[model samples]
Target: MYGPVCFLAPAGVDDPQRPSGGNRYDLELMRELGELGYPVKLTPVTGAWPRPSGADGRELSRLLEALPEGSTALWDGLIACGVPDIVQAASRRLRQVVIVHLPLADETGLDPQVARELDQAERHALHAANATVATSRWTAAQLTEHHGLPGVRVHVAPPGVCLAPSAPGTPSGGRHLLSVASLTPRKGHATLFAALGALPRELPWQLKIAGAQPDAAYAAHLHSLIAEAGLTDRVSILGPLAGAELDAAYAWADLLVHSPEKEPWGMVVQEALACGLPVYASDVGGVPEALGHAYFPGETAFERPGRLLPAGDSAAWAEALNEWMCELRLRDRLRTLAEQRQRTLPTWRSTALEVAMALGGFPSTPWHTELEAAPLATS
Candidate 1:
């Protein structure tokens, strides 16, 4: 009797109509679920995720007023999460579910008040949901371990990726290494630059870092650092890589690297892997869980994050990059290994089934059982 459900997220950026990172992910799945015979609705936040708009209160009010008595509306990002004093009174009467993508606690540089607001709201969302899902066990553990929720109660649904099929050899042979991450401080682009500074010679490869320039001040810092490191000619800051732009970056890259300090679940890692490219991700959050040998084949899987100086050490990040760039045989071997791993990787069809299960009434069919029992028996 759960009627057609809705997936709510910060739909767009400041414009409210432009699609952002997680918004695209949520909408894509919503459409696929709808096509799979479930009536699915997408609700946008007044503005964007992490940046709640006054429109948020209005949107929640609209959802409450519009939904029929017993239907559910599932929220898709961190913004919709914190059911605080504001949201507690605002959304209390509604039937809701929350898919915890990443909590805001890791935004260590944000205002304390903002962090507290998120804390209060997310806890309440977790408490009130008909069900809440965590994209990784790491996140579920954080909630359960800190918030006192039963870990088993929160659903764990691994993410899925859709990569454009590419002819690997021709596309990946160009002279560039690609790293995709936001402009946030935690993403560690500066470290990669510093690491590159230490190389004896600038290899023929150039490094392209893509994502929106988050804050102007941070962008200024990166610009200064790159100039100081003498990398203006070798490193390019390509703003907001999406769709064909991102595909072309992938199509022209020699390899991929991600060095984020606050990566909860890296979507780009999966995208790169699915594109038949290799990845060298920092050792943090769910990156290793997604790319380690357990889930990926031997060659394609990185040797987990090694002692690259420290987590945010730019000099150390450079060392890793330099070493990785020099190892052609290793990269080739891993690329082959990844192809084998793709054989077991989950597709959107399987991801949708898992999502359906988390929403309660989804059945325990063969698809469900297979997913329930699967995972790399990693130590």
Candidate 2:
């Protein structure tokens, strides 16, 4: 029998006040892996990850030292990527797998030197890992190209989405737009506001943003932009909402507007798709992959669930929003495609199985074969 898999992640992964794609992925993946009977043990670490304090580093080292020798453990890149020395030391005994959700240097608004330093640290940390798992094909490719890692060493295990009830879109044909991303520079809330500001007052659209304000300054800037654009009345900034509240936000919206400057794999994209909410997002990172091709069965002609505009381009975003708001036929077409894609979306079970296989080095185990043979269910 395969031994237990030790999964380590940030302790705040389940914090409703700090909801994020990475946190959601960690929570769902751990739960699903356990449900799949993988004998998984979760070790939630507390710290300012990717830049933990010295005390946090010592705690992590102690945890690693306590684990049985040769035990397999998967560490979230947020925790592992910034501390090469600690991880390298742990590598002597435990089998290490690091899951890179996003390259550390890809975060927006970092100083050039800080970005470079982070990039260097990440390269060292990844090299110390026995194998690396990237959450998207784009990320895996980026790691191989940017970090000089052998392509074979980095594996792809895209985040999966649970199918949600189809959103009952508004009668206004796509007037209620929703932006679900944290109030941070990387999420491009400021750029989204700029795009919305450029739209004509007669467009008859209202936006509701639902995300955590982890950065006080960025949140203030978003509010400032909203006021500057005279969108104060048209935009509602609701702080982080979880579970049914988040679901209601999706149900209440006609479209999901994602404006991230850098995203590795947008869990929100697939979540939006699962709810049958078409996404109009920046064409960066693995967003295009998450917005997978939508089409009728056996049909060669396919349509994207929504539009992909240039990242951080307010003009391009304005153009797409105008088109979505004014064109009823276009709105109908996109909605249909979104629903089609939703039906075929991958589930968390499959994602867990993929992670299991990756951790097991694609071993031909009995459970692996059984799970693979079982058809994935879509609600």
Which candidate should be chosen as best, given TM-score against the real structure? Answer: 2
Model 2: which residue pairs collide? none
Instruction: Give the alpha carbon lDDT tens digit for every residue of 1-379 in model 2.
Output: 5678888988977778989888888888888877877777888998988889999999989988999988888899999998999888888887788889999999888899988988999999988877778888899879977897655556677888878899897886688999889888889887888888998889898899999998788789888889999999899999999999999999999999999999998889999999998999999999999999888556778889998889989999988998899999889888989999998888878777777766766522222112233221110
lDDT of 2 at 262: 93
Q: Per-residue lDDT for 1-379 in model 1, tens only?
A: 3368766666463332232445555766676677777788766655455555667666666666766655666777465564343344434555555677788667657788888877766776666555556776677667766665544456666677775574254333535778887777878887677777778764766888888876889989998998998888988988877777888888776567788877667777777777766676777777766664523343343443212235677666766666666777666666765555454456666656666765653322331212332221111
The 10 consecutive residues of candidate 2 with the worst lDDT sum are 370-379
Query: Candidate 2: lDDT of 224?
Result: 86
lDDT of each: 0.64, 0.84
Model 1 lDDT at residue 34: 74
Q: For residue 47, what is the lDDT in candidate 2?
A: 92
